[model samples]
Target: MTPAEVRARATGPTAGLAEGYAQANLIAVPADWAYDVLLFTQRNPQPCPVLDVTDAGSPRTVLAPGADLRTDLPRYRVWRDGELVEEPTDVKGHWRDDLVAFLIGCSFTFEAGLRRAGVPLRHVDQGRNVSMYVTDRQCRPAGRMRGPVVVSMRWVPTALVGTAREVTARMPAVHGAPVHVGDPSALGIADVGRPDFGDPVTPEPGDVPVFWACGVTPQAALMASGPPFAITHAPGHMFVTDVPDSAYRI
Candidate 1:
């Protein structure tokens, strides 16, 4: 589907949509907090890989010129004092002159490569969102931004784990490589069927769970830091960029 079509279906999550285009996680905060957020991303590149940052108060981004950040994404989450206040399909009403938007790399960009390499994504196959869990591990803090690491889990066949890693490792811009493979408990995940965000997909008997750092880490940090106001793409919902998937492949 085209990015516009994905936006038209704004109520649904963007996972598995716009196959060849790059998808990003959105984080918009007051300009005062931009530097800290940038530093946080720089420090935690795996989960918070920086893709683009808009000029303060402006929605235009080089990644997708002419796209409207306020209305282009599938869905948005509004936060007030770290509490979720709204989940809206459009954020035009919440757009502020002091808001700065940051686009972070999303693993969705690499799924195509995985599919090409014969690594099946059960979530996509089942029409469910990938499972995400908040781990006990804390990210490297930057200024006031600090929170537990969030991970997206996919069940990979034990034999294809290496293929999955090699395919994703080439796309460093979209969070290259797996952070953890096998044993979800090692990452403090108690139940494979339950997730803190997104839908859970059951693993086949021969599949082993693989974890990757997720863009939701920054949103978790923003919430923990108690930022007065913030906006982010709802988990699984993403901002589709005009850039091609190959542009980020290394």
Candidate 2:
């Protein structure tokens, strides 16, 4: 069933299956820590871009109007003392009246553009998660949040490089533009085969490795800081919102 259709039928496990709508990486922080994390996202717009921030205890975002944050995503990770303790299909048990949620655009938003542009995404084509790595590069620190910028990598044909560039460049709100376009080593990525998260994709002779700032940046930052209490969407499961791709232009 479609994610939206399934979501309508039941509020259970198949939470965000109807993807291709605008997807966002979610971060739920204790109210006291919300401002600091907001500052971090503001400082590093490329790696930790902000799409929306919800008032404490509210899951509905202006980005999607009536969408429910706690149940919209298929799964969530609950962290305590900076360590992941539970991977819940829904955050109902973790939800709190004092928590605030932030929604950041996911790379899938741009993948739609790439698919439209004919730039094949091997990871999605193969139904495998995109490869992501933590770079030696650091995001500008804000408050207590600081970590190496994490990136999601994809391989595209040499001939369609310009197409990949042009389409993604138009969607900065969803992490537009490739951060690195050639050698993986330039990004301090030792071996494309050894990714920190997600599976690796094969690079054909003429395909160049292209990396983008990932929506998962917050998860990496969360692990590094280890906040007292926080929640985030599971890696593959994301909130499919009512917004459209064109809404992210800027």
Candidate 3:
């Protein structure tokens, strides 16, 4: 499906949808805090690779021309004083003139490469959102933006772990490689079955859990820094773009 078609549906997680296109995580903050956000992403590029940044007060992005950021995404999270205020399908009522939006490269954009490499994607196959957990590791802070790094988990077969890494490593823009390939405990995750965000995915007997730095790291920062006001794509519900996944491949 195209972005416009995805926009029409306007609800639910985006995994496995618009299969070959690049998807992005959306985070729009007031103009005053734009510099901090930009600096934060630059300091922590692995979890926050930038795809596009919009002009203040504009909902249009070059990633998918003519698509409105305010409504194109399936769901949005509105935050105030570092707390989640709402999860709305449309953010038109909350769109602000001084808001500057950042489109962060999403791991979902790299799934096609993994698929082509024959690395199984359990979450996609199970019709569930990928599991995401907030880790104990802190991100390199820039200005007032600071938080623990968050990661998305996928259970790759023990033998295909290397294949999964190589396929993803070429696409650095969308979190190029796995941060952890074996134990979730190494990241301070006490329970592999429970996630801070998204759904839990069970691994098959021969599978090894693989974790990648996630775009949701911004949301972690949002919650930690108390940004006053912000807008983000609801976890798992990303903004599908017109760019092909190959565009991000090396």
Candidate 4:
């Protein structure tokens, strides 16, 4: 589907949508907090690569000049004082003049490359949102932003793990390589079947669990270090951009 189609529907996850186009994670915070968020992404590049940043009070982005950030994504999470207050399809009503929207690179941008390489995406195949979890590993803090690292899990056949790694490693802007393979307990995750966000995907026989740093790491930071107001794409949902995925591949 096109970004216009996604805006029209305003629901569901964007994984596998717009096959070769880059998709991004959205996080719009007050300008006062923008520098801190920018610094946080700089400190944690793998999970928070910045694709494009909008001017304060403006929803326009260079990544997709014609798209409106307030309504382009499938869903958004509104937060106040670090607590989630709403999950709205459109944030136009909640939009503020002091907001600075950051378009962070999303792993969905690299799935096409993986698919082309014959790496199966179990979540897409199962028709479910990718599983995400908060790891015991903490992200390096920047100013007022601080939180544990969050990771999206994919189940890959043991033999194809190398292919998955090679295909994704070239796209560092969209979270490059797998952070962990097999053993969820190593990441301090208690259950593989129960995720902190998104749906739990079942691992088929011969499949091993692979984890990648996720853009939702900012949402975890928002929950950890109470920012007065913030907006982020709901987990699994994302803002699809006009840029081709290859533009970000190295």
Candidate 5:
């Protein structure tokens, strides 16, 4: 689907759509908070890899020139003092001249590679958003940013675990490599069938739960820090960029 088409619906998740294009997570903060977020991302690259940063008050990104950040994504979450206020299809109503939007790499960029290598994503097959969980693990805090690490989980066939890792590792900018290969309990995930964000997908008999650092980690930090105002893509609804998946693949 084209980015414009995705923007029009503005209510569905972006998973299993826009194949071959790189997807990104959006985080817009007031100019005063941009530096702290920048430091937070730099200190925790695994979960918050920087893809592009727009100038304060500007909604256009270099990653997808001509696309409007305020309306290009399928959905957006508006936060006030760290609390979710609304899930809007477009954020033009909330746009501010002092907001700085950050586009972060998303693991969706590597899903095509996994599929090409014969790894199946159960969520995609089931037509559900990928499972995400907030772990007890704490990210290295930067300035006012501090929160538990968040991860997206996929059930991979046990035999293809190695191939999955190798395929994803090539795209380091999009959260390459699995953080945990099995046993969701190890990551403080109580139940694989119940996720903290997005819908859950059951694991097959030979499937092992694999976890990857998620772009949602920064959102968790933004909430914990209680920023006055912030904007982010709703979990699983990413901004599709014009860049191809191959551009980020090593």
Candidate 6:
């Protein structure tokens, strides 16, 4: 990502310009509440798939050892009192000595699986972010963290629907399965043209919309919790990890 672009997202620029390695989602919360949030994650494994957790007051991820959470993400969102107030690329200025970092699995980790299976992604093709929505469904709540389940949607050709499911099902750490499929209204989505978070994609004829348990689910929970402070990787931005996809393969 360009400096100006990362600045806009406030998550910072993507490093290791050459090879595209693994990337994880970064969620930062106050140390006092880290235990609660970590338990929430453990309870909701699929939605808050934890890759690594930093020690109290540490921003460095043990899994991605040398990586720095404060400036590694291409974008970051700062939430205050349950409402988002800032979307910065880096959280250095906002970082606190009491902060705790959690590296969670990201959906981007499975894009290659979808591509290998030959399922077309309209969002990537059209240069738009995947569609995401806030569903009527509620997540397994934990202390101060509970709310509607948020999901990301991708339209796939009817013929390739099975392929999409098969490929993605292999990576549960990264939203392992489709929570819902085919109907948007069933998920409380009134209009596919305008998504709640990311850009909407054109759903062509013979394409079925598929939804995945998005990493953003935690963000939704954070919003509901309205903890005094919280941080997350911005939409489309992620934290690159050192692990290989093969390591997570089933």
Measured by lDDT, the strongest candidate is 3
- CA shift of 179, model 6, Å: 0.9
lDDT of 4 by residue, 1-250 (tens): 7766765674799898888999999999999999999999999999899999999999999998888999888899999999999999889999999999999999999999999999889999999999999999999999999999999999999999999999999999999999999999999999989999999898889999999999999999999999999999999899988899999988
Off by over 4 Å in 1: none
Give per-residue CA lDDT, model 1, range 1-250, as digits (tens).
7876776665677777889889999999999889989999999999999999999999888988868999988789999999999999899999999999999999999998899899998999998988999998999999889999999999999999999999999988898999999888999999989999999898888999999999999989988998899999999999988899999998
Better of 1 and 3 by TM-score: 3
Could you estimate the TM-score for every candidate? 0.98, 0.92, 0.99, 0.98, 0.97, 0.90
- Tell me the deviation in Å of residue 96 in model 4: 0.5
Candidate 1 vs candidate 4: the TM-score winner is 4
Off by over 4 Å in 2: 1-3, 6-20
**Residue 158, candidate 3: C-alpha displacement in angstroms:** 0.5
Best-to-worst ranking by lDDT: 3, 4, 1, 5, 2, 6
lDDT of 6 by residue, 29-131 (tens): 9987898789888888877888888887788776666667887677789988878999986788999888888888866677767777788778777767777
Could you give candidate 2's per-residue lDDT for residues 62-179 as a string of tens digits?
8777667887676788999789899887888789999999999888777767887888878876667778898888888889887789898999999998899899888888888999
Residue clash pairs of candidate 1:
none
> Residue 199: error of model 1 in Å?
0.6
Q: Candidate 5 residues 1-250, lDDT tens each?
A: 6755655564677876778889999999999999999999999999999999999999998888868999888889999999999999889999999999999999988998899899998999998999999998999998988998899999999999999999988888999899999988899999888899999897789999999999999889978998999999999999988889999989
Candidate achieving higher lDDT, 5 or 6: 5
- Candidate 2: how large is its RMSD? 2.7
Error of 1 at 209 (Å): 0.3
Task: Please give the distance, in angstroms, between residue 250's alpha carbon in candidate 5 and its true position after superposition.
Answer: 1.1
Going through the candidates in the order shown, the clash numbers are 0, 2, 0, 0, 0, 11
Scanning candidate 6 in windows of ten residues, the lowest lDDT window is 11-20
